[model samples]
Target: MKKETGRPTQLITRKFAKELHSNFMKYRASIIAKYIKKEDANAVWFSVEELENYIHYIKSKGEKTGYDVNGIRIYFGVYPEQRKYAEKAGLMTVFLQATGKKIRKAAKEGEVQTLALVMDNGDGDISSIEPMNYGSIGRPPSLLY
Candidate 1:
């Protein structure tokens, strides 16, 4: 089989594309279902600005989608510095690859982190505040400690 450099020829890439599409569909459906089941009509999952900022931030760092988990597509290579900004914007569950392997905050390798909101801090500035890890189910003290 001859391999094409620019375009994918009859190879495993086709199967992988199909798999990604299927997974995306499932994720979309789950999100819709969750929203529908919610009692509050004004309930917000994520705002447009937040999502746009997240995508922009992720792209700015040259990080790509690592994988999809629970309807959220995880992107990898988000450094500790970038993680704070992403988390402040409400992006969590970062992964190292599309295989769904997670990454931890401030980890050297194979670390996993789940970002959460700390508080409004009454400054009306989410960016002004730094994200803190009080600890969670799957997290351990970062090497910084």
Candidate 2:
């Protein structure tokens, strides 16, 4: 009788297991990146109240640092749960409520030029820009989107 060639059932060593685990992690990261990009491209504008709730949600979900960029206080690196909540809330409502006062002030001052709405993945990567303007042209950039 001839011996049959079959798959070996053996335990993987620690080094190999670690490498495999690392590869899986990288793959997961890539998937997350793609999802973030898609979400960013489809990001909506949120209100001040919504934004505040989102910030709170982010804090609850394990966000540690908040970034202040060009007068825009951005809360990033929120946990998956927080991000999901924000997404469910949508951009239009959340951001609009969050920055309602600012938007109103800009309108009153006639300094609102454009509003750029953006969303990011938890991994330090951003996706898109949704721009909204108050007037037709030549307005100063006093808006933070």
Candidate 3:
């Protein structure tokens, strides 16, 4: 008569439970990060070529933004969702740009975020150069982006 013990279990105490939860979150995040691409999880990925094509398409339809350039193009005017976001921020409009030549030129070195382009033939693509906080005109030093 001997009693046998199998595998040992971690006793989840209040303090140990907190540590266990924190460690589990870290481990889970690491596992998920290994499987997820940064762009896939956080942002939309579009190519320069795609943008160029979209620009050409819009231009063909006579839709142009004031910021169209060889590499960068921007479409003005607020869309329904964008308008909602802007309204939430108490803004009448949110000037947008793609991370192209014009956007780089407009944004102070780091103010620009990744450009998001959503294609639409009817209203043209929706392009947003985020952290939309810049001006377009000023002396040689303060032009908007």
Cα lDDT listed for each candidate: 0.33, 0.34, 0.37
User: Which segments of model 1 are wrong by more than 4 Å?
Assistant: 1-11, 32-88, 97-145
Candidate 2: segments with Cα more than 4 A from true spot: 1-8, 33-145
Model 2 score (lDDT): 0.34
Those runs of model 3 whose alpha carbons end farther than 4 Å from true positions after fitting are 1-40, 63-145
- Name the candidate, 1 or 2, with the larger lDDT value: 2
Judged by lDDT against the true structure, how good is candidate 1? 0.33
The TM-score of candidate 2 is 0.18
- In angstroms, the error of model 2 at 54 is 41
Estimate, for each residue in 1-145, the C-alpha lDDT of model 3 and write its tens digit.
Answer: 9789786685556887667656744665346445642111111234566555655654433334433333333333322435544322221122434332222123335558644443332332235423222322222211112
What's the CA error at residue 94 for candidate 3, in Å?
15
TM-score of each predicted structure versus truth: 0.19, 0.18, 0.19
Per-residue lDDT of 59-119 in model 2, one digit per residue for the tens?
4332223321121233322224445554332211112111111111123244577544342
If both were scored by TM-score, which would come out higher, candidate 1 or candidate 2?
1
For residues 61-90, write the lDDT of model 1, one tens digit per residue.
322332112122333222243555433222
